[model samples]
Target: MRKLFATAFSLWAATAAQAENCQIIGNQTLCDDGVSGQRIGNTTYWNDGSSSQQVGRFTYNSDGTSSQQIGNHTYYSDGTSSQTIGTTTYFSDGRSCRRIGNQISCD
Candidate 1:
């Protein structure tokens, strides 16, 4: 499940939407309407309004591979977020490793 979770997180991080200048409005809420992605430096943010909100970042490696990262899942909105150092490394060889907290899985 590590790989799956990491892959999902990475996908969202790469394709999430940001509200141009999305900020905490009305008790930490944002104006994100989901399906839009924004990259402010190394941060990314997305919200589906229905409850799927994500925030993360990704980097394109010099070797043609890539990686997605985030400090932790602190933007779930439901206060049930439980992630630490979510990371997924995509190798140039088509292999990948996903590590969340202390669990590592590859596929």
Candidate 2:
């Protein structure tokens, strides 16, 4: 009976530890993978499992738009990079209409 009680207690303790190690925010689950930072929001996974050292960040706007900044890359709402040097525009149908510049190419 003592052995059984010890096993049950260990199981319960393990479960409680796991539950305390993670949090659910928005649609994302922030988990600490022992060495890394915590995760944040729904789309971003942070470092050492630490949310303080964010490895990635994603923001979804109310206008049916979204943006993501991962490392050195910045993504815009139109699924394009914000670092794009040339000027570009899109039509209502979600098609690239025009682009102009020496390094530019129209989509």
Candidate 3:
């Protein structure tokens, strides 16, 4: 869940319609999206007071749930999953986002 959340957040922030600059400072990554993240060991802590730990292909959330990524597909412990095809990602719940150049459009 955390991996998906983090990846989705970063990906969206990076490719949003409005240009955003991202920079890495030490172990932390800061972006114009107002979200900052620091990676310590396998755990990633965010400025929004959330964190996740990565173990192998799995990312464990603070709430005890987990998600795993195998290839371009991510599977959640709750039985949900998402798949990415090219620059487009499709979620099990029917949400999807597609990136074209530096812009991303989602629905």
Q: Using TM-score, give the best candidate's number.
A: 3
Q: How do all the candidates rank in terms of TM-score, highest first?
A: 3, 2, 1
Candidate 1 regions exceeding 4 Å error are 1-86
Clashing pairs in 1: 16-36, 16-37, 17-36, 17-37
lDDT of 1 by residue, 1-107 (tens): 21123234432322221111122222232223323333343333333322222234533422233444445432222222334443654433344445454333444
Can you tell me which runs of candidate 2 are displaced by over 4 Å? Answer: 1-56, 84-107
- lDDT for 92 in candidate 1 is 36
Q: Give per-model CA RMSD.
A: 15.1, 22.1, 5.4
Residue-level lDDT of model 3, residues 28-60, one tens digit each, is: 766656766787877778777877777777777
**Which structure among the candidates has the greatest lDDT?**
3
Candidate models: Cα lDDT each:
0.33, 0.28, 0.61
Model 1 CA lDDT for position 66:
40
Model 1 lDDT at residue 2: 17
Residue 14 lDDT, candidate 1, scale 0-100 = 22
